[model samples]
Target: MAVRILHTADWHIGQTINGWDRTFEHAFFFKELKEIVVREAVDAVLISGDVFDNQNPSAEGMRMLFHALADLRRARPHLTTVMTAGNHDPAGRLEAPGILLEEIGVSAVGMILQKDGGLDLSRHLVPLKNAEGVIEAYCLALPFPRASDLPTLTGESAKEAGSPIVRAVADLYQRAVSGAREQIGDAPLVAMGHLHVSGGDESEASERRILIGGEHAVPATVFDESLAYVALGHLHKPQRVGRDTVRYSGSPFPLSVSELNYKHGVDIIELDGDSYSYERHALTRPVPFYRLKGKDGLLVAEVEGALEALELDADLPVEQQPFVHVDLRRQTSALGLRAEVDQILSRYPVRDTGVSIVSAKEEGQAAPSEIVSLKKLEEIKPLDLFYTAFEKEHGEGPEARHLELFHSVLAEID
Candidate 1:
């Protein structure tokens, strides 16, 4: 019998974009995921990690997570789900309702614990069984292990020159793999990890760095050849580690502008007998993310043209409007740039679309002037300070109109 599984990770629920809530996007993603699960007739679901954006997620975020899971279970009563906690999640919080969740065939492993002062190997290991109650695969459900998760080591192993965190993580995986092999003997082993793997490409803009105890990544070779597949998380780009068998499913949505260009999706794996095959399933986003830049022209005019060129369906929902980042060339002053951009955008029907302005000037350019002496806070007037800063940046003090505006503001304060 073939065992089909949907592989996904880094849900990062409660995540926001530019201070705007993204709850609608997450809801749409879950709706699509449910459709995929039903269409594929998947027997199991493997969610790698980063289930929440932070350790303390909001109530709405928690509600969405539970509702999504409940909907999935209702759609497929025979489905089995295995989820592990990522660095962003509070392990204890995620695993608090473990006993209750298990009643619905869902298993969550937050952190590996010591039983009787010894590492409990069984906690990280789970057997994936079919509806007929037959064990088809053995899964090493390893969560993001902190310094306290691993067992204490002595002798030369503890005194290794490299990072102690790396050594401890490797040791934990080694023990888990050994225990799983001993229990199942080789029934297409699968391992789930929420750590950064060496050689895996990362979406730096979106993924949070998972450095702990001075250790950032683990070598891909640590997975071993015995495992049929190594499902990984932490990175926000779907990619292979050292080999195709070991892969990251990435985040379901474009979490940042860096991830906007690539196709976002999940992996569908079919494990039959001793062989396993997988395919990527692309997801359709409710709103497209775009980075817009002006060509060689006046900043205001360039912004106006770019916004005008975009063909958006105003009839669509607000969440369906495109989110854009506008880049403009250097100007004499950026005083009214945001207002100008907003004014141009308002002409279009995409009022709900978010727009951010960025200066195209190269960073780290030398200032036009240098300060000769530092003045004490009480010694310098507010207007004097503003003029000095403006001269240092623009090679000149405030213009007559700017000085007039400043004087009027002072008059109002008086």
Candidate 2:
């Protein structure tokens, strides 16, 4: 029988959009996900990482995750789930209940442990079984590696391979795969990770840039060829990198407007023997996103008129109402933008994401404008602000080494 595994990532269970709670959306996703597990008869579920939006997720977020995991296991008694920690997760917190969670058929790996002064290969290795209860595959349940978690490398040898970080990642995977093979003895191997692989599309507004081991992102080849399928997280858009077998299932819903068109979904990989294939299943968006503008661009003077002229579903409950974004021509007083948009939006039940103004002088050039709610500008990350300031002062962004130093110092502070 072909062993079927449903792969997904970037849950961000406690995530919020424009300061709005996504608990309802997450609940909707989980209900459907449980239904999928039951309907498809999946043998296993692989959650790559980013289980929670922030390291300190609210208690409600934890409860939601626990309930969802319990429900999934009950939906398919034989279904095995492998979940790992991502950059945003508190590794220890996610791992604290590991032993307890195993009772419900979940294998959560938050951090790579140590044993006798070497990496703990056994902790990262997990076995997957078919409906017949026969073990058919092995998984390297590796979590996101912090800088300290990476293996040390030095000298010309590390340099010859590539950046030390890239070489270290490749080395870690090689070692893990070797150890897994030593024990599993060639049952097809699969793996999971949470990192920015080169070529994967990113939604910069929501995702964080986690620089580790002196590199901002690593290449897809960091995975060993022996891994039949690699489930990845980090970037919000679902995509394949370097090879089709390595893929990201993307987030289940839009986390930011930059991801407005992203196909939020799950990927099912069916593996039998040495051959495998995958298919994507799109999830219905619980809340719709609307960008209000004319073919040219909505004029600021017509903003109220347009708001009055639009039609929206009246049956949608206030919480499930569509998210609205308004666009206007530049030169609209930034000072009055929020008041004007708020006054107009107050008439409708929709949630306003923000207002953006296009530069009229550069009509043909399409550039994404900063949201008019000073909140967008207020949300500028330290790194981004530093990058802009450095470029303005030095005619260029900071060099990689400079960035690496900054990342290291910041990590220490955190």
Candidate 3:
């Protein structure tokens, strides 16, 4: 019998989108995720990492995780699950309930605990049991490796190591894999990790750098052919690294405005004896991310026109409203662009996540565009921004009357 396993990661629970709590979106995704598990008759579920958005997650976030696990256990008592911690999680805290959660068919590995002066390989080994209580496979669960968790090396063997961090990481994996092989018998061993692989694409705005300069990403070679599959996390984009067997199951929902174009989903691995096949199932994003744009640099008139033309469902629930980001071309000024975008978006049933200004076309100065989020709008001076806006709109210098009118408005507001 082929055992089905669901591979997922980067939950980023308790994450907020521009200060808006996304509990509704998460709840919606979980509802669909649970359905997928039950419908697929999944025998095991592997959550690679990023269980929480931050190290000190809110109590509500804690409830969300516990409830999701308890609900899954109730739905499928025979199901097996293994979850690890990411950089965003407090590893030790996640492992606090491990002893109690193990009885409920869930194994949570927060960190690679060192015991008795040697690495504790006991907690890392998890037997993947299929429905009807048959051991079909084994999972070597590894979490986000802290610098402190990595083994130190010295002597001639250490001299050949290209980078200390990379060498330590590779050795840790080899040790864990070697230990898992000792007990898996005829079962094909699978592994899970919450770190960046050499070739995996990253969402710059959402994913945090695992290493200081991101110079020590583990290579795919570290995962040898002995493992049937390797479920990875950290990177938000779903992709195969080195081979199809090594993959990342991206986050279920978009975590940042930069992820607007990303297709978020989960992966399913069908394990049969020693061989397995993989498939990706895209999840339905409950709250859609809609890009609101204008032709070329948004001319003063065109920007307002685009906002009025934007169609949004008036009766839509606030919690289910789509996220909006305005793509404005950089001209000479940002004086009223952000304010206008904010004012117009407020009338529609949508959440304004960000306003991105594209770099202006200037001869010989070839420069990269700066994405100015609304959060940083306060740093800009009002008059300076208005002057830039004035020049961009009219294609000429601002008149003294324009400045006088601007000050008059400011005085009126004051």
Point to the candidate with the largest lDDT.
2
**Tens digits of per-residue lDDT for model 1, 1-414:** 778888899999988765556888899999999999898888888999999976667788988988888889888888889999987776777899888888777888888776664456577677777767677876788888775676667788779787666777777778778776777786888899998999878784455346454356888877878888899989988999898899999999888766877678999888888778999999988877766664432366776667667876677766666776665555677677666776776666553223334442445764342212212244344655766687678764444345446656766786
How good is model 3 by TM-score?
0.86
How well does candidate 1 match the true structure in TM-score terms? 0.81
TM match of model 2 to true structure: 0.87
Question: Which stretches of model 2 miss by more than 4 angstroms?
Answer: 158-161, 305-310, 360-414
lDDT of each: 0.76, 0.81, 0.80
Of candidates 2 and 1, the better by TM-score: 2
How well is each residue in 1-414 modelled by candidate 2, as lDDT tens digits?
678999999999877666667888899999999988888889999999999876666789999999999999998998899999887777878999989999999999998776776568778888899999988888889888776777778666666855777777777777778877888887899999988898888795767556563366788888887789999988889999989899999999998877888989999999998989888888989988877777655766787677666577777787798887787766535777766776888778788777776554444666554444335664444566766677678764454345556666666776
Clashes of each: 0, 0, 3
Q: Provide the TM-score for each candidate, comma-separated.
A: 0.81, 0.87, 0.86
Task: Name every residue pair that clashes in candidate 1.
Answer: none
Give the per-residue lDDT digits (tens) of candidate 3, residues 231-271. 99899988999998999898888888778788888999999
